[model samples]
Target: MDFLLLDDRTNLKLSIIRKLEQQYSFSERKDVLCEELNISQYLLERSVTEINEDLKQFELIDDMELVEQSSEIILFQDAQVSSSVVEEKYLKDSLEFTLLQTIFFNQFTSIKKYGEKHGMSRTVVYKIVDRIRKELAQYEIKLSKNFQLVGNEWKIRQYFNMLYYRIYKDSDELYNQSDILAVQELFSEIKLYCEEVNTLYLFKHYLLITLERVKRKQHYFLPNSFKSVEFDQKNKIYQTVAQWSERTLKGTNREIEVEIRGIINQLSVYRLEFCDLENDVVTEYTERLKQQFQMNMQLSEIGPEFCTSVKMTIYQHQFITPLIDLTLRAIDLEFFHERYPIIFEMCHTFIYQLKEDEFKFSKKSLFFNLLLVLSQQYDEETDKNTINIYVNFTQGEKYNRFIKNQIQIFDSFSIHFQPVIRPDTDLIVSDYLPQVTFSARNLIWLAPPRASDWRNFGNEIVRINRELQLNKKRK
Candidate 1:
């Protein structure tokens, strides 16, 4: 995650761009802007020049002014390209980024030789490697004396997967095209359904690692946490991947099983639905927790779906390193844990029942996940969004905030303002049409919305929330 962050200079330029765009005046005096960014006018002007140069790349097609200094005021607009594209460009340009991908692919490159070919000093190369080595050490991985990643081979794969998955975003940047196709084909044949985010790239990263290691005659050493673990070899996906591994690796059956168990373990843990899994690990864990609730807590009101979700969640923490931090979203759970302490206690007590020898159960992961799932059940505010709305006007961020504030005066919990467009967005209020296609719905297009526009918006909200209530009642 540290590696994904841009250098301070690049970060400053982006911050400056965002700062100017956020101004309701839509322009900032050069001196004021420099003061706001805590930089000298000289550096500010040079950063602006750099920004202009990058914008010039699209100048042939982008006739509209995106970023400019009109006399004393620094004017900024959202570029035709997204912030992500800008970040990706900066990421690829980084020497540290290149070195990381180099190590991931080549595995054993001489840094001095690499620096020589790249016109960088040996000191600079090792400085970069030292930074990487420190980060890898946090994950219990070693950047070995041989310049290869060493440790639990599975963890090494996870470490790189996190790095590549964050940086690449499914681009052909670091993956083999054939491997993507084959993995996708296997997924289709198995009819796997996993709702965990970024699963496509997960398959890509692991498959690439598997192919690379297998081709090099490097058999994976199974982690102690997975020792003596049982898997449903009869599961269609498991059998399919196993057969593929056997045919491709041409290794002893034991080695092939090791690969299959490792891969399948990951695939199963992230699955949104495991009713199809022959072993149904979640169901087993769910049943155990349910018995505990019945005998100790005298509580069986927890839904089957909720029980399964909680169990699968703790199960995953045992094997998977968290791909992202989502603490803020689950903050409400802390209140619940304090108020209904027994629910939290029941969850806490159930964790001790887990296998001491095989599973690496994370108490914190379980706590966070319980918070996330339980929030929907107990936090009444979570259901307040009956008609989610995203306000984006040509007038930009400051104007959007003003409009959102005005809408809040309505005192309607049913009409929640979403920071971003979501699948359930009932309306989008903007002055100009968006550049992308969207499902046709209530779209208010008004530069200076009149009294009539407000009336129409209110009508639309009432209609949307009524339908929502009706649907809920029917359910």
Candidate 2:
């Protein structure tokens, strides 16, 4: 057994590898794997090599291998190792990572009990607890003396739900199969009343925890301020959940009722109206934003997809404020404020309009969602007539600052410029274009920027825009 210090990335890699191993044989393209893992090809290859080395130590040689790789595809094969062996090895080697699982899934009441069960000294357990506390602090959650998680209950549930997925992602027994199936059936019945994606897994985990707590005579009481579903709707869902639980868990009617009520309360916090953005209020708000920002976009140009995003943002803020708080906490505010200050400021102004109690949206949620929507909308406008431009510069920090300023200017005119080479590039705007062959249609070279360079560049951009429009008209 080995106790390795695992960063989040490494943990994710191991989980990915374990999942791949379970399939025994599968063919995935390199690009597809990279997209799934949110890593580059080079990083993915390195991770596979590292995972192979780890597998070797456990005498699982030839158990998993990348059988083939090419420009278009990557093939993986596993030698069909028994489930027991893999589960045993995973549990032994990843015990530290499993500590949170024990605390969460088992509802351990005290640090001493956890230490005794793990065969670790109290001091070692405390250190681990301290580390967990630091992690929880990122979400503004507190670990209490009774080994309880204290925070906005919604945030607590979200945190634990995510943690559960990460820890058991590779395991077939992540949740009881029957329980998951039950949740799926319940969701199908109630699908018309809510809009959700991949929520069954989380709901199953919630149900499992609720049942465990009930068995131990523990209860979660909803606050008086909690807004539940309408009585008739809640009762219908409660009856369905109760009937399923009675057959599945053999829970008493009273106990099942309590658990159903708790589940419904949590679900209410996440249920979103499918067509909320089609209303006049959201349309009026979108128009106000365009005028305030001096954007050239018309109401129709913003599209239904953008409107749907706005509705989700509103729902998140109004019903799932804690999730929005968690998202804001994860953002690098200072970096965005520095690089995209204009957009950031615009977000603030837009958020201010939604500050009324009726809207119930937090400033942070509005700012984050508004920034995302505005940036995408601006990019779409820019892409319509402008060419993609990849920047090449040598002066490091100074060049970086120059590029950021250039992006801001280009954005104002709805002119697209990549400033970096991405998969789909159209032109190069650089201090000096590199000699390497490129598929882009044009290149605009320049000396290092001077005070008048922006004016000259703006004029050139306007000329190009007119040329593109003329080409379109001719076609």
Candidate 3:
């Protein structure tokens, strides 16, 4: 049987070939195979006989003849995998490149297509893509944008890539592998890093625009700034924004803007550690403004309310709820009169799900009102410890035993909890959480948005009503 032989370094050479194919032509670069073989100066002196027989597994020698007597001669002899066509030959076992091609070409084909091409079962092709993902994780080889990792169609990227590549080929703008990488960098970092609600809105807006253009068979062009963002900066911004958003969504009662500020200061000084700007600088500025807004939680500091309205309607717990409502209203009316939207949202969330009326009016009103009323006094920095201890305690017969206890804890300082009334509504106020102190200066924490708290509270009423129905059924 006439057989082909490869050297011990064949695996490495194959990898180099794959990388080169990703960069340039897979066919014309066939002569450049010597570069990918990477035989060192020391290996030049070693005779083929002296080399270990285990190297035969790589098929380095064919019929015991030196394939190329001179390294300069790029000869093509019979090998296990032929080097005939770019699609069939070069990409023989390269499931990674195959998946990438699908994404680049936007060609959606069934697993059966891959199975038939590779002489494998449909299940085998699925497994190959899965293994490729696991193997290329170090290289960050994402098959497509918007790929969801879990669920039955875990290979969702495969389908999406095929579609995108097909679309790309038809489009006027030519996007090669390098351009794809650049676009990926832009979306993951620059778009994701702009953490401002408004900036995020813009990112979504642009993404929708890009996606829409692609859908309409239009060529897409991202701004030059988007394509130039460095890999490391992109990584940092993505990590920072991801962490910030996770914490904010949790409503963890940490200082929101202060934490974000630290992210900015780190980015500002990142030049000392690494020299690269690209899109990171632009994203840094956006994050900086978001951090600034977060630092100033005062209602008056936000812009003119203009067309916004601060509407407060009582639905439950009429007694104690008034204390919290009236105090927030006082701040809105006297200081942050312009930021009616925020105030209105705050009030809306505060009473989002209270019952219209509870038969036991006193008990109904007091506990329901207490929850919202207590939360109003807490700031962006209120600790979990404080909430657990001072907000829910039911020690004396007093209605707000929790607040009363908290007042003692702060020595009547809780009275100062009345929302800060700004003397100058037009004047925007800013403050900095100073570093170089004994505190954990680098940590900027955000209390997660308790939007769900109100929503869940409303849901709880329905749940209680349902339980009563079930109880009556059993009786």
Candidate 4:
């Protein structure tokens, strides 16, 4: 996934940026980064010089320099840019990227002609295409001799969805202006028929991909095993999609039906489905996942909604797997994640137990998305340690209430804002210098708090929670 979006040089650049990000105080000796990356100090110095230039060129520096340097030390300024933003910039500038975009949108298929258009030799164009071919082949997709993307139409569309997403992002750039307008109307029409079009930006992109693929006479193909699962032809969502297909897409009746089913399958699995509610395979696997997640600390509560969401995720994954897929994903093991370690490990164990040899990205998606949903439904261990806070300001009760309103996180079970000060108060937050002077050990604030004050307030909460844990252990 990383390789697809960034070249080695950009990856190396990002690695440096990430390392610098880990240390909030940005100054690191050039020798330190050089040793960490196992490169020469001179090389590291040169890279730093280039990095400053690259950051400016990326146009995402956002009026703040992301990297700075002295002779011996590289200094970093937090540009507050996300990894995705940086990645899109790098991806857009790649030679292969431009070539592929031209092929997809501009029909620049002839290698020699492409070189002439782009001022590169045919050999260089061939090499770039070869690399793309190899990468796509890894996902069971083929860049054909005529440069057509050949594969299962569903998977191919998914691949193009990612490519277009990474490059254009939320921009209106998938097709020409007229076609973009047409697709927007098509999306609006579908939105009228279905309320699940929650994100217009993403659905617009998806509709464009579908239109482009259908224009190329590419339609959906399902695996034989899945073909056995029966669909309700009269299902409202299915009927709506079929009707839309008739009006919008160019295909035979069967092809349009298959494509419509494929589109429904691409939608959220929680919706009214064509085949999954009673499927034994989906139900059995859902139960198996629940059983596999048995752990020391249970979710404080598990409602019907949580169970249904888990079931539907499994159902969706069951039908969505291909020999390989090209969804843009980067999944990290969440065993040590602070907030949801229990849920993370439980999800990991359940996913590991599944005997099927699935693709890395698919397993990653299941684990990542399931953990996200589980964390939302469950409370953290930290939430159980209550921190009773007394808010006192030189200002009156109304002003104190305003402060509380500013910082209050309603969902946190760990922190409670007490109405009055008590001896049992775990912490004190006050704007009066005299009030917090004696109890500086707990926490303090100013009338107009700075960002660092809020940060310190959070740190105090963590410290109080840790103290409670230690006291429980002593008992």
Candidate 5:
């Protein structure tokens, strides 16, 4: 025979979830529960399974019924799995709420009633309650969330709460004083800074002051008034100070604009500088960045289509599985990243490859062409075979051949060319070559129009006809 014990934590969770039956979702409950309980998702799931089994043993079917009736658990599977986690989560949220209630509202009875109703020990309730109060007190006088301290730097009131909790835990005055005067001092300074400069740094200064108090615990007592406090709003000392000293000192604003202009001018003046390189390296690196950004956008836009489409199974089996695991792990790793080291390495490797190839542009051109074709052919008919065809066009030394073949398939048209820039190894054309232009080239780079505008091309053709007539006359 198995017996189920209704623990304080479990009871608190049930009460909390029932109260917030409308606002919270099953998934959110599960996540919050796991976090509060300090348990892994796997462990949380196992606990919920065990709890359900226990409930069945005790004939507590009504509890299960109550949960099922709650429409917040819209999906049966999610509702079934979330029971234990939600219970744990609710207990934590309740404790946090109770702490705030007791500290700010002076509603200490709520904490006592909560514990008594849930059959929890008053001592245990007080312990949890005290912890939250201590946390808030650390923030000092800034009790409300919206009453943010702004100066040369602004900080949220919550930061002060955390700070007070840290510094005054052992101090005698912390328990004696109901109102946190130290926190108020910082907040007042923030208000003054905001009034004068409309700056955010006052908050930062407040945090620094809090940190200093924490560092020197003996100097935790606040004086009646500060000497440097300004009497006037339009004081010359406050007006002269720059709001963002760090940015002004760094001088990155001027440098960035200058660098951007330099890059654009280089591209405009020497377009052939890109063409004087090998194909493979340049194409592989630049195409990777372009494809990565494109893939991200496509995934965001067509996410729902993947779930409902007939090719969902095929996409999951062939495409998503290969990348999703690594991608998710990389994202998780990014949260704790000090400086995005791995992505930086990938960028470095890509840039190095580009430099090694001596700046080939055709590879990038072919890559762009492949993307354009892929984007255009993106439909229900685009199976693995169709994708492979485009992929092969990008792979190896097949790009030039692929482009030339496509050009041949395009309709023939009249064209003329003149050498624009004749360097050591390559001749960059300024004018169209005679009888060389085709529908494919015209369509391929539709925006650029190869060398000249359509109107200019017509004028050039007319000019050539007159020149031919004159030469015939001279003959």
Candidate 6:
């Protein structure tokens, strides 16, 4: 079913609705739903309201209400309509969503084919195609006359994967139980190399997708280098995937290799250095980085765990696809240059020496990782008075000067403003909150720091500083 028409919030609402159906009529604790769904109470409350508004359109129910009491939320479903009817109505409303998925997967290659499959008239198909075209345009993708999608292949795949996850929420429903079991078995054999559940799911999803695409006679060309040499030849994880493909797929070795590479590219499977690459190579690169940066610390200084992490990062750059966007990374590089110019210069020099084109895609991530390693060594000796603040502003030079002044005035706070929000930030002093979720308890929302705003801003800063002190004391 084409559930992409329903955004994540709406999908979450429907999930809640379906859960309510199972209960028939009962008071379910909000915490239970929140824990199951991994959503905040604020988000659950908001989704409930939006879902009821949508339900009202079908005249299926008066409204689904969650009556809040002490430590519990009571859910009341409309008895007038059965849960199955509500589900069917939603499925019927989601045909356009399904159509988009069909187009993306190259399942239906023409308006006539789509119309035939869905029992829709030519006129209706044309309208849906037009809407799809407009939507693709927003992503700078093109919908051609024959229903083929024309765009950067990675971006096309990205959009498809995003929509797929938004609709299904997970990969469990995308494949049959047998196929899932097969993939799980393969994952188990190599679980020590990568044990993350999300990573396993992603690998399985792309593997299934790649198999389907290959069976449909859709093939990707392997570059001469990847085909000529067996990359990560000694890696057990690579060996496992390659062996599975040989036994399961009906293709030549070269074609199977291409499919395996395609899955790797789609999943961005880095952090495989545990099984790939030699220790000497990683040590050489690590030493070069330290020398270029003129840092006194050695690889051993950061200890074994962090040393492995840096090596994995270096290995990851080798398989990265070029088309993926690094705009945020570019912003991070700029911010690091402004805040810690010397360290950023060292990173730039080290990356330049590496001379790998793929480094362009991940130099920021590398720099950040290197920075963390350095911080581990240096932070122990440094005082803990400095608070890291992330400033989000775009007034150009004015914002720059304002940040400089703030850093000087609030010397105890290490102010680092960027075009993007960073996770390591102690406080967010932004002109406007970006449409992203953050968990900072000390977010100071204010206009650009003018002379008049400083008093109130300073008060907020003091409160946060005190809170931090209290937290430290409790710890």
Who wins the TM-score comparison? 4
Highest lDDT against the true fold, candidate: 4
Number of clashes in model 3?
21
In model 5, how many backbone clashes occur?
A: 24
Tens-place lDDT digits, model 1, residues 1-475: 2432346788777667666656555567888888888999888878877766765653522522334556565554445654445555666667767787777666447987898889989898888788777767766777777677677777777666655655675654466676656666666655643333345565566667776666556678676544223656666666777777776664778888788776776674565333232235545766765666565322333443453456556556545544323111112344445333445566666766676532332444566666665544533322443567888998889989888888886664446688876666678888866554556355665766777788777666666644553343211
Q: Per-residue alpha-carbon lDDT of model 5 for 1-475, expressed as tens digits? A: 0101224545533533343343323223556555665666666555555545544554543445323232122222334433444443333335554354344323444546767876788898767655553443432323333212222111222233323332332232322231234333433543553453223222332333333322322122112321111123254322322222222122354433332222222121112221212234333434554444343332233222322121221222121111111111001222111122222233334334544223221223222222333333332322111000111122334553443344332121222222222121111212233233222122122223433344343333334333332232221
Off by over 4 Å in 6: 1-51, 55-96, 104-124, 131-159, 166-169, 176-181, 192-199, 223-230, 264-270, 274-383, 386-459, 462-475
lDDT of each structure? Answer: 0.61, 0.55, 0.32, 0.64, 0.32, 0.56
Those runs of model 4 whose alpha carbons end farther than 4 Å from true positions after fitting are: 26-29, 61-64, 71-80, 193-200, 227-237, 269-277, 303-306, 321-336, 354-356, 379-385, 388-413, 416-475
Cα misplacement distance, residue 140 of candidate 1 (Å): 2.4
What digit string (tens of lDDT, one per residue) describes model 3 on residues 1-475? Answer: 0001122343344333343333322232334543555554344223222322322543544522222244332223334432212222223334554554453345536667757876888776667566555543422334433332332121122223222332232232434444344334444554444433222222222223333223323332222322221335355664654454444322233433323322232232212222222234333422432343343354323333211111111211121111121111001121111212234344334334334432122332233333233234332323211111112212323533433343343321112221222221111111223223232112111222144433442333333323322232221
Lowest summed lDDT window (length 10), candidate 3: 306-315
- Range of the 10 consecutive residues with the lowest summed lDDT in candidate 6: 322-331
How well does candidate 2 match the true structure in TM-score terms?
Answer: 0.47
True-vs-predicted CA distance for residue 34, candidate 6, Å:
30
What is the per-residue lDDT of model 4 for residues 349-467, given as tens digits with 9 covering 90 to 100? 87788766543446666776687667665642224656678887878888888988886763353567877666567777886533333343455677788877887876666566556
Model 1: pairs clashing at backbone N, Cα or C within 3 Å:
none
**Residue 376 displacement in candidate 6 (angstroms):** 8.5
Sort the predicted structures by lDDT, highest score first.
Answer: 4, 1, 6, 2, 5, 3
Worst 10 residues of 4 by lDDT: 322-331
Q: What is the number of residue pairs that collide in model 6? A: 1
lDDT for each residue of candidate 6 in 389-450, tens digit (9 for 90 to 100)? 66656566677567657656765444444555556555666666656576653444444555
Which stretch of 10 consecutive residues in model 5 shows the poorest summed lDDT?
383-392
Candidate 2, residue 280: how far the Cα is off, in Å: 15
Clashing pairs for predicted structure model 4, backbone only: none
Model 3: residues with Cα > 4 Å off, grouped in runs? 1-10, 14-93, 103-106, 117-119, 139-475
